[model samples]
Target chain A: MNEMIRSLENKPGLSTVGGIDCDLHPASPATKTLLPYLEEYWRETFVMRGVDRLSLAMTSSPSRAPINVRSDWKAESGFAGDTLEAVRTQALDPFGTRLAICNVLHGSMIMHSDDMAAALCGAVNEWLAREWLDREPRLRGSIIVSAQNSDLAVAEIEKRAADHRFVQVLILAQNDEPLGRRRYWPIYEAAARNKLPLCIHAGGSNRHAPTATGWPSYFVESYVAQASIFESQLLSLVAEGVFHKVPDLKVVFAESGFTWLPSFFWRADKTWRGVRAETPWLTEQPSDIVKRHVRFTLHPVDAPDQDALARTLEHIDCDDILLFSTDYPHAQFDGLNALPAAFGETLAKKILIDNPLATYPRIAADFQKEVAK
Target chain B: MNQAVLEKEKNAEAKLGIVDCDIHPAFGTPNELAKFLPQRWRDHLADYGQRSANPLVGTLPYPRMTPGNGMRRDAWPPNGGPPASDLAYLQEQLLDPLGIEYGILQPLAAGSSTLNQDLGAAMCAAVNDWQLDKWTGPEPRLKASISVAQEDAAAAIAEIEARIGDRSFVQIAIPPRTIEPAGRRRYWPIYEAAEHYDMPIGMHSAAFGWHTNSGAGWLNFYIEEHYAFSHSLQSVVTSMVFEGVFERFPKLKLIVVEGGFAWAAPLMWRLDKQWERMRSEVPHVKRPPSEYIRENVWFTTQPIEEPENNRHLLDTLRWVGADRLMFSTDYPHWDFDDPRYAFKVPLSPTERQQIFRENAKQVYRLP
Candidate 1:
């Protein structure tokens, strides 16, 4: 491990920052997570595509995705601790320095039948309470909510803002509004008030790149399809002045390639100058706001093209805004070591430890203190 | 033939010993393949060999992408600029430039495009003949994978019999998209024919359409569909494992072309785990899925970028072992990788030799 780290330019001291997506299904606290329908259902779909959120594999499964929010999320699956440990052993502990971002599934869709959004909120809070908070200072998890039920989602954030364990609010990005709409304001307001970053992830169990159409054939094709999602989402958020309203709220474009982050900023800023009159509320160009607020994580790094990412940052005028990530364990994700391997030790140190520390200063200060000891 | 002379001169590089695994031969040009194929199967193939399915996807008003539904165009045969007619130039530029010792020409069209198995036999005959007289036959270093149509066992076997005499042929290639296992009892005739010819079976992926023009109307666009070939291989392996394909034909070997090695370990574990409870599904198998893969199956590496260090690459190589895998360039595809880079990997000189040349020669039993 030391030798590997050395090759990765071991820049001394342990820093608590990193994240990987885990494969744990949300088990009902009342009984076993047998997945009795797992085999009988779209067994082929399960193996090929780890997506079954909408149960598209199961024709019997419903079609619509509601932006649902839980009213009373409270039950615990009793598996959070084990799941974290596995993420560590199988992924984080092996490669990353200290802790990992645990991207969990909040039931399947955004909306629910019975305060479904609230149930997920309470469940997320319970998991944090049992597994993270104080017990594991290094642990950071996303507070999952639905786009369908924004009001209830705000309520859930208000309820749990004091808990540091719930670090970010995660919502699947395929929604009715192009990501930057006023409809997302209430949720942004709540998140800013609570000191939480908002993360928009692509589809997995739920619809991610379901897009205006459907999934693509190759990883390249799928990634290309999502390039627009990031741009459009950024444009929507900035255009609607969600950032201006929720000044303190951080927007993390997690798991998308950071190589394009810089370009998106430049292009948005360029477009806003010519088109800012369409919405005259903003004090600055779209690029300036996003560069100040947006952070990106690297997953599908184009191995042959490493320098391109760094170059893009220079072009977009925001190298400091960039954050390194290893979207671990999913079908298209790389292992934790990928960050270190791809960017050598110096950049890896900055990407893994320093940049994240800078973004969430409280977490960084605590981490720096830990490494000092 | 003299290793002593070649060894003394290191600069006399062997174009880094590139062994192309997923090389394609033109199945149909908009103008020509129709000429060679029986009129019955030609139209269907012509539809698929067009652009990789229509872009406007869905079950709505748009015409769904059926296999062979469009005028399928061969990406190779580079659109009439130069007929692969300059055979000697192929040997000099393609062979000498890459320092490629051997190129295995696999059949491009399965049914009509990549999967129609009825024409799987005839397409194989046409490609093999073209590859020999036109491409590799003159360029001795260019070997070929004999394509076979196993939709009908008898016809596939006859195609093999006709070409078995050619030394230029190395392995028999098939599309991984077929619903039937490569080891099905029905395919035994082709397998036996391969063994008689001392050939291994090499499989490459086609869009699921190779089986029929009505390939699975994927909810996924081309992005997901392109890699779906790996799943097809898994289906092929599952079929083979369950139906006693390996046990019945001990000498037969299956080489998964184009699919990367990262997914293989996980697939083996999943198969073994599922088989534990689902043993009733394949009672014919005695050992675990991993064992069968270790014994009879091997995968080729192209855009191999997993496991950062040379040690990681070697560990994966050792897990699957250096012998089972033989490296290939996947030349002319969007994924074409540098063969020289394989040596740059932190592996020892011996591991390098095995991956580059020795192992391939032995696996395909090439001269």
Candidate 2:
């Protein structure tokens, strides 16, 4: 069995046979590449409005930077993961990703006009569905939406919900406002209604400075600071009473380093004990709410050493809180060993498949259907 | 269960007092600073109040955790004034009852970090005097921080120089949120002054309208704002380290108050990790980031991070170095820590004495 598995792994194609890949990036080739996916009216509108050659890449994660993409992962002339075959060979097949959730992070969230943003989101989703998921059985997609307008975001979610392959909805970690605000509640309502987890990936719309004081001087500061941004978003959701409003909502912080969770949970819970009156909707401790509703992707796995990693996992404690991911072609880690060896087998299986299945009911249901067939 | 253990527990409450490092003393009113200001600034105050970068007038842009605008509900003075105003009331409630030996006062008022430099400096001077007369004068256990409008570097230096030798003042308190990262070369003059005076810079978490509490933008809830305090401290620590503030002033020390210390160890590890990869971008950072943090920075414990298991907290404290941990109450604030119950771990008596009193005494050179 081991010899057969090893031989099959060497084949040049995507596979979700044994494990679930929670995070993978499938780039929208470019604005020009996505033009065919858009309705003709919007396509002409884009050309007439002179919105040609849109860079869709986040400023924080500049596509051209050496740090953004690994040297080995890049294709001959363009960026890695720009094509379906490259994603298959580099991410899915190599990592033995039984199922991979594609988070198409093209800078649609930054669009100033709600209509344009909504239209671009529609285009991105259609592109993912037709170009990636339709062609690849192992691939699943995130429903891209313009969080700037809840009505539009809801509409987008409803439009994409018909496809069971799209298991989650995607939003940038940095947004115009907190994800818990009522303005964004409709999006959550739609996501919850469709059993889709609201996945907050590491990229941002660059709508604001990445830190509290102001724009950081270096890229590393901005990069390291996203975890805090995710923390604020989590606190916002808890404090502004979002979980109470949308009880079934599941959150995935993809590319957010997981080591900060224990301390953050501690601080949040501690503060809630004193200030619970302000946020009356919080019925349980912040950590309790988080453990039940939130799942973190393990990409950065940012701990100083093996002992530190062990300590972080011990603090996290719960088996269901982490999901495995390569964060493919994004230069987070080196080689095929995306899951750190220190994680061990039991936790590895949970992160790779079980936790993800539990988090996304629709995906689990689909997996059941596939097995029966 | 033993008689000696019971006696030690009882004795721990009575005389083993905490040297509370973060006691906020607010003004009874903005008008309290009138005596310290000149006519032009006074007229400006009447017409414009504080022309701060934030929209609100002499208040935080967002409300905080509790009823008395982030103050402990019980901390409100019996005489119908703002909390932290009446010294007699503070002593009666916080100092006397908590068995506070030497509580360092962090006067958070309308001064320092305000836009109008002259008014800010004058109000800071006034706040310092008020700290001396109103809070510390009758209460010998209370110590003062020389408040200054940090933007006006020369004026800030002058203020420090004025109070350089005064034993009544122990440190220079600067707000965590500033126009730039507090370690920018523009702010180095203040560090120079602090080092020359042998005073540690107290960077307390406070709202400055110059920017949102979190860089991603304004947070919705006070809980989020509260969490952002540690995040702000993280930025300040990074700013200090990457900007070579330590290399510049080898003797200078920093005490980050109210922003819990559990994040300190991890942040240092992260900073060091990133510095290794991006060292060329910031060549001035002489040593690994953790080295600068361990040697130069001290963290106050308040709103302490409480993991479900006490062992995790102990491990974190071990990583942060027991000597670097100073016990702070954040007295009169909503989230004040009771030193007796704050630390969940079983600290050795020597560890307790160091964290509670000796560490602070050593840092501030207290007699």
Candidate 3:
């Protein structure tokens, strides 16, 4: 067992200094913690209804799952990433991350009531800004939005567009409907208008089972099945003409493993050739559109070994599509060996720093201002 | 020559033909299948009609892209029947030309995973009987799959028992998109029956299911829905591995047909990694998930993944052992692969033999 682990571990030469971590999960705030951030009317209603006592963490990442918390990183109480101080010392400091994007996975985003979902999502964004972004100089945030109502989702994106710290708009891969439906176009339009990339992370609303064939008995199945969810959503986005409509929209798939991309691209491109007339809006191949408009975060590198990872990267063929991420506090890897050993220094620099800056315009603008100063 | 050299030469000579594992054989006419069903079912088929979970009745909700109901352009027969409906046409178009010594029939009639359990089971039995009487009995090179509605364990087992000792039937055919993940205890009886009979279970990707094709939601275009086949199969593999189906039925063999094999290696890696962290949740999964998959699962190659770089395909094949892949053309389908041109990479003679003929022959115990 020890030998197997050692063989799978990334080679230790890559440096993390000044790298931009694309995906870091800050713990979902308990309802009690978000009371101050919520509007007065909603806050009062929450208190009156006793909703404040509930733990609003999404079920996608169960609190007890060993993969949710590394043994060394757990705090004295609650989840390891619950506090900004813990994140600063444990996630941001260890890797010397110049900028780490925080994607908060709260249950509020998946609520049944559209208005309530909107209200709670707003509060979570406010909480993220005040509690984490205001204190940490090196941290950035993703604006959490509920897609149950597109108007409400667009409003949230517009509200957070002014804040440079929120580099992208975050939505779940599995939602009430496929994210590429025309109903959700308003959200993408708003994202493009603001130059904020859409970040579809690995989690679901629990509206449906994580697998197409209904629910599995264990979290292990659900977690491993996330890659397929990502695949479906990507195909939806491309086939439903979301890219053609929102041409400027740069989509980032965070916490979605990239090893599946090569075969998926092949299948997508091959099928598109035979069925091109079905989606005439797509003038080019699906893989071409994906390569042009989409970027993937690196974590939970699902390859078996260095050689396999290298082959995957080679098959993917585009250097600009992968952005660096620690997937902080999620136990995707141990210590600072987040970047696989297959990457040489040049490719490592591109993935860790260059690709992220190019993907998120807001982050790049902030970097430009800092450079000018 | 020495004895070892003589044996090697003989083995090489014996490995000349191919075992095509995923040949879809359609009924010659709707009434042909109805003839095999009971009179009650035949009346129900005519009166209430054959219903599935999809909204559209008597047609697919998302129409297939290719003409002739998603068949290859040239596959439609001159006798005015749908592609693969006439065995003579199929033999002429695929088997004779591809040099297929043995062809396994996987009928995609949506009989195994439909919402109507009774109708599903009836349709499955009818398809099984039709395969034997119409195709396999007349053609010795062709073999039948014992079709069953997997949601009804008793019905599925009974169907298997009926065909237990028949050499005409090579394996049990189930749908990847079932009422539940293929691994749950609900489906264990069928697995036990397969094990007892020493028959492999073939999970061919089906088009109809109660749930949407994707985890996200119902898809919009045929392309997206077609791509969902791989995702559906991936979930089945994950479920079966983590749910300890293999641990409980160690000798049960699974041949995942039509879904490409490139994704298997990475999925196994991910499963093994997660099992190491979450083994307590599934204590019955005694060994690494990859070990069970490598031992119990076999994958068919059709709609084979065509990576831009041929070396990458070689890497995937190396990771997933060459011996684990069986050559399949998904015959008569729009995305059929010719055995001669499917693989872009140069394979050694041994690897080629294992993939094209030896592996399927061993798994199916074919003559």
Which one wins on TM-score?
A: 3
Per-residue accuracy of model 1 over B171-199 as CA lDDT, tens digit each: 87766654444545767787777766668
Ranked by DockQ, top first: 3, 2, 1
RMSD of 2: 5.1
DockQ, model 3, C-alpha based: 0.68
- Predicted structure with the largest lDDT when compared to the true one: 3
Q: Is candidate 2 or candidate 3 better by TM-score?
A: 3
What's the lDDT for candidate 1? 0.52
Candidate 2 lDDT tens digits, A40-72: 888998888766566667786777555556678
TM-score of each: 0.51, 0.91, 0.97
* Per-residue lDDT over B1-367 for candidate 3, one digit per residue giving the tens place of the 0 to 100 score: 1222212324554458899999999766668788888998888878887788778777777887776568888888899788898888888988887789999999888888666789989999889889989899988899999999999999999999998878999999998988888898999999999998899999998788868788888888888888888888888888998888998899999999888998898788788778888888999988888898889999999889876566678888988999899999998888998887788777777888899999999999997
Q: Candidate 3: where are CA atoms >4 Å away?
A: B1-15
lDDT of 1 at B51: 28
1 against 2, candidate with superior DockQ:
2
Q: Candidate 3 clashing pairs? A: none
Q: After superposing candidate 2, which stretches have Cα over 4 Å from the reference?
A: A1-17, A48-50, A76-78, B1-17, B28-30, B61-67, B76-81, B96-99, B137-140
True contacts kept of 3: 0.76
Q: Compose the digit string of candidate 3's lDDT tens values, residues A1-373.
A: 6346445474674888899999998877889999998899999999999999988777888764788888788887747788888888988888988999999988888999999999999999999999999998898999989987999999999988898899999998889888889999999999999999999998889888787798888888898988888988898898889988888999999888888888887778877887898999889988888999999999888876787788788888899999999887888777788887887788999998999999999889898998999
User: Clashing residue pairs, candidate 2?
Assistant: A16-A97, A16-A98, A16-A99, A17-A98, A211-B215, A212-B214, A212-B215
